[model samples]
Target chain A: EAGVAQSPRYKIIEKRQSVAFWCNPISGHATLYWYQQILGQGPKLLIQFQNNGVVDDSQLPKDRFSAERLKGVDSTLKIQPAKLEDSAVYLCASSSIKDSYGYTFGSGTRLTVV
Target chain B: SQQGEEDPQALSIQEGENATMNCSYKTSINNLQWYRQNSGRGLVHLILIRSNEREKHSGRLRVTLDTSKKSSSLLITASRAADTASYFCATAALSEKLVFGKGTKLTVNP
Candidate 1:
């Protein structure tokens, strides 16, 4: 089984610019999650998708951050007008709906907002 | 918001030594999981202990969960330099959402 895959291992953008990160979850996994990890801190959940429908997005900054998992497979997280504080690692993970034990994570996209 | 809080924020030990990290969380949880993240890499699942189980082990890792105390501990025995990484504890509440702790950065010197 392949691990979760993410693109653009690194990204740099000026403040107020827009950027997007993509993720492809493990095969057959029904749940996907997006998390933001700041320097010197743990990863925090930003959004969660059960198949194609969103199961949680309470922590996502809807005003600037938006994400979608189309066709219940690949997911894209976009940040519009990126802020300096948005410079962090964006991680994507997936797990089996029947097995809630743990998640398999992607390498992540390191975003630098200048 | 983060639910679990890891203690000792950092730890340093020599190879072949044991390193123990602790995590305390608020609210009732259905299960607790441990993850390891190497610098510039994604996290890898280490172990999971359910509310009913008091202890579990995987390879050289040992995890103990005390629901009565709302705390858990991860012990790495005979740790090697390769074990150096950030360790995080995530608590899954009754819901499917998992809340993570700030994490403990461990350094195993060879």
Candidate 2:
């Protein structure tokens, strides 16, 4: 089976610029998640989707971050007006309908804001 | 806010030695999971221990959960240089959020 896929392994942008990262999860996986991982820190959940419907996004910075999983398949996360602090690895993960199973993650997109 | 916190933020050991890391959480949880992230790579699930369970093991990895203390520990026996990475403990709280700890950076010297 193929693993989760993310686009633009690395990105560089200036502060206040808009950036978007895309993710394609494993086939038939029902749960998709987006997370931000700062250097030397663990990942922080940004959003979660269950079959195209958002299950949780409490940690998401609504003012600048938005994500969508259309048709319950591939997903995209966008950060507008990026800040210097937003420089981190954007990780995408997927799990089966059964939440008990752990997640499988993609390689992630590393974003650097100047 | 982060729900879990790990102690001994960094650890170094020689190959063939044992490494142990501890994690403590603030609230009740349904399960706790351990993951490893190599440099420049995404996280890989190492093990999962449910709240009702006390211990679990996979290969050289051993995880123990103490619900009463709201803490868990991961022990890597016979450590290898390939095991050099960041180890994180994540809690699946009642709210369905998997909150992660700051992580423990492990360096295994060959």
Candidate 3:
């Protein structure tokens, strides 16, 4: 089986500019998630989706960040007016369910906002 | 508010030695998971230990969870050079969100 796939392994943008990241999860997985990892820090959950519906996004910055899982297979995360603090590795992961199972992560998009 | 915090931000050891990393969390959790990430790649699931379970073993990796202490530890026995990477411990709360710790960077010298 193929693993989770993400686009644009690296991205460089200017402050106040807009950037978008894409993720294609593993086949048959029912849950998808987006996380941000700053340098020397662990990943912080930005949003989560289960079958095209959002399961949780309480930690996401509603004023600047948004994400959607169109067909429940592929998802996209966007950040508008990016700030220097937004520069981090955006990781995408997928899992079969909400149980104790672990997640499969994608290569992640490293965004550098100058 | 980070839910998990790992101790000894970095670790260096020689091949054939054992490497141990510890993680502590603030709240109750359903399960705790360990993951490894190479330089710039994504994280790979190493193991998962449920709250009701005390210990789990996978190959050279052993994970022990102590719910009473709200902490977990990952032990890599006879570590190899290829084991050099960042290891993270994530806690899955009842709310279904997995909160991660800052991770420990391990460098295994050959």
TM-score of chain A by itself in each prediction: 0.97, 0.97, 0.96
Model 2: per-residue lDDT, tens digit, B1-110? 78889988999999999999999999889899999999999999889899999999999999999999999999999999999999999998654567889999999999
Model 3 stretches astray by more than 4 angstroms: A98-100
Q: Scoring each candidate complex against the real one, what DockQ results? A: 0.84, 0.76, 0.86
Cα misplacement distance, residue B30 of candidate 3 (Å): 0.6
> Higher-lDDT candidate among 1 and 2?
1
Q: Work out the iRMS of candidate 2.
A: 1.1
Residue pairs with colliding backbones in model 2 are none
Clashes of each: 0, 0, 0
What lDDT score is found at residue A110 in candidate 3? Answer: 98
Residue B26, model 1: Cα distance from true site in angstroms: 0.2
Report lDDT (CA) for all predictions.
0.94, 0.93, 0.93
Best of the candidates, TM-score: 1
Please say which candidate is ahead in TM-score: 1 or 3: 1
Candidate 1, residue B80: Cα displacement in angstroms equals: 0.6
Candidate order (lDDT): 1, 3, 2
